[model samples]
Target chain A: MRPVVPYVTAALLFGLGVYGVLRRRNAVLVLMAVELMLNAVNLILVTADTTARAVLPHSGQVFALFVIVLAAAEIGVGLAIVLQLYRLRSTVAVDDVALTEPPVSAQPVGRDVEAGR
Target chain B: MTGADLLLLALGAVAVGAGVLVVSTKHLVRAGLYLVVCLGALAGDYLVLGAELVAWVQVLIYVGAVVVLLLFAVMLTRAPIGASDDLDRPGWPAALIGGGAGLGLSVLLVDAYRWSTVTMPGAGTAERLGEQIFRSWVLPFEVLSVLLLSALVGAVVLSRPDIGQPAPQRGDTAGDTSTPQTVGADGVRR
Candidate 1:
């Protein structure tokens, strides 16, 4: 098999991931884009395993496995964070999620942070 | 081109196409579904490249766990189910950057390979991969396990907001909060 096919594929995938990450507003969608980039990297590593000479056998695949593990952990924790964000802020848009605390007047809904206290 | 090359090319096309749909589609759930298609096609590419174990692992972890987790987050966030126009920022910038990156990399890779054929490697059977992992890669493997443990604990802690915060206002299945103007804001509006 010509190795360039997979290499170019990985490249385009990574590019798409970059677009998704930058374009998507939702945090979950951003995470999905991040997954795309990770997958593209994994594809490159696995392709390199077959094409490039390496000292350790299956090293590319091993790194791919590690990448997979990392991705799994990432998604789990990422979802937790997203869900939590939804809980507190009631939205998951990357832009809408302000880094600094909003003024008390800007609180969207009547949460009554003081309710029942 | 051999059958394997053709298969790889076809699967690559599927992956790239679905990836486009994943980022472009307006339907919130459909994007997740498109991701499944894209990832599955990549798995096929892996099989064609002789990484048998990696292919299956891709299917198992990426297709199974990660996509599921994404869908759950989508639903949990109450993301708009059908099409909403404003899921993305202005298209030109993303398109320009993504296109530049993809085309440049493609040009470089194509130039490097330049129609050179490669001998396919031995199939990465589970047994051989396991041996390599346990023998030479044992330390990283153990460390990865620790990372996974910490991630799990951290996810649990992060999800359960009551852990650190002084007041526990609501549960994980967040409801009762009327989320106004959440559509253009780009997420769920409860």
Candidate 2:
């Protein structure tokens, strides 16, 4: 099998993920996009490992396994955060969660005035 | 191209196409399903590359556990099962960027390794992989386990904030809206 084929495929997959992350407003979907990107990287790693001329052939597979594990942990924490955000705001839209400022009326007037200085 | 080459090309096509669907599909459930397809095809690609252990692990972890977790989260979050109008912004900019990146990377790769072919190594068996994991890769594996444990605990804590807090009482206070309490038939907060 030609290595360039898989390489091109991984590149396209990563691009799709970047698009999803940048354009999708839903936080859960964004997480899914990130998963896509990680999977692309895994493909590249396994491909390189398969084609490597080294004595030990399992390094690429091992690295791919680590990436998979990390992706699992990432999705777990990400989903938990999304669930909590939904509970607090009743929406999973990324635009709704404003990290820069508190929700209107939720912040005390005195605290807002203190920050104004 | 040989039969193996053809199979690899087919699998790669399926993987990339499903990956695109994963990010572009409007239905959340369908998106998860596409992710499964994408991951499954990638596993097939690994099998074609003679990495049996990694292929199965890909199937077991990504398709079985991770996508299931995502689906559960989707249901738990009450995401719209159908096409969600509020889930996306303008598509033109994202499409442009994604296409540009894909084209650029493909061009770079082809330019760097135009006709180079690397011979396939021997298949990575389960025993060899296990030895490597327990010996040279031991530290990173153990650290990953710890990370998984912490992620489990953290997810539980984040999802259930009222785990250690005292249950609300009828006369406690009317101003506490932070906690979501359920009232039982006996008029006590559960």
Candidate 3:
């Protein structure tokens, strides 16, 4: 197969992933998008590895393997965080989890004073 | 086109189509299933490219372990299984960005390579992959193991925050006056 075919596929997959990551409000879907992007990269790597008839032909496959392992590790940690977030907030919507301080009007004066301390 | 080329094209189409479905599906569980299809098709692509070991690994790791873990999390978190109104935002910006990126990258790649073909070396066997993993990529392999270990620990810690915290004191009963335990939503004392 020509190399461009896989390259084009990877590019489209990556773009879809990027769109999902940006547009999805659910945290798990965002994580899924990230996985799609990683898979695209893996496809590209394997395709390039297959095409590159060099001294170390297996290098690209090895790299893809590593990416797989890393992806596993990443999803593990990411889902754990998501679970914890759900526990804390009772919801998995990313927009609701405001890491920054609440607006001044929304803050309780006593808690705000304690936080200042 | 040869059989391999045709198979690659078909699998690529499946993979890309499934990938799009994965991101666009409103049902969370359906999206996970679509991800399985996409990853499985990618494995088939790898097989067509002569990376046999990687293909199976993709099946074993991604389709087997990762998607299952995602589903477990979804079930555990009680994520909405059906369509969710808040699951997505306005589509235009994302579609614009994603489509533009894909088109631009495709144009660049086609311009760069101009349909040139490269000869594949040989089928990558498990034996050679093992040698390369142990002999040349030993450090990274070991490091990945370490990473997995750390991720396991982190996941455990994050999921169960009470693990390292001090246990309830001997006098801290539900009725104890000093502890001031509150009833949770499920009517459990906390």
Where does model 3 exceed 4 Å of error? A101-117, B163-190
Better of 1 and 3 by lDDT: 1
Please give the DockQ score of every candidate, comma-separated: 0.65, 0.43, 0.49
Model 1 pairs whose backbones collide? none
The 10-residue segment of model 3 chain B with minimum total lDDT is B181-190
Candidate number that wins on DockQ, 1 or 3: 1
Interface RMSD of the predictions, in order shown? 1.8, 3.9, 3.3
Name the lDDT value of residue B15 in candidate 2. Answer: 88
Error of 1 at B58 (Å): 0.9
* Candidate 1 local lDDT, A1-117, one digit each (tens): 899999999999999999999899988888989999999999999999998888878899989999999999988888888887787778888898788877773332334432322
What local lDDT does model 3 show for residue B98?
Answer: 86
What TM-score would chain B of candidate 2 score versus the native chain B? 0.81
Q: How high is the lDDT of residue A85 in model 2?
A: 81
Which residue pairs does candidate 3 place in steric collision?
A: none
Query: Which candidate ranks first by DockQ, i.e. highest?
Result: 1
Off by over 4 Å in 1: A103-117, B166-190
Candidate 1 per-residue C-alpha lDDT over B4-121 given as tens digits, one digit per residue, 9 for 90 to 100: 9899999999999999998888898999999999999999998888888999999999999899889988887877777987788877898899889888999999999999988877
Best by lDDT: 1
Better structure of 1 and 2 per lDDT: 1
- The DockQ assigned to candidate 3 is 0.49
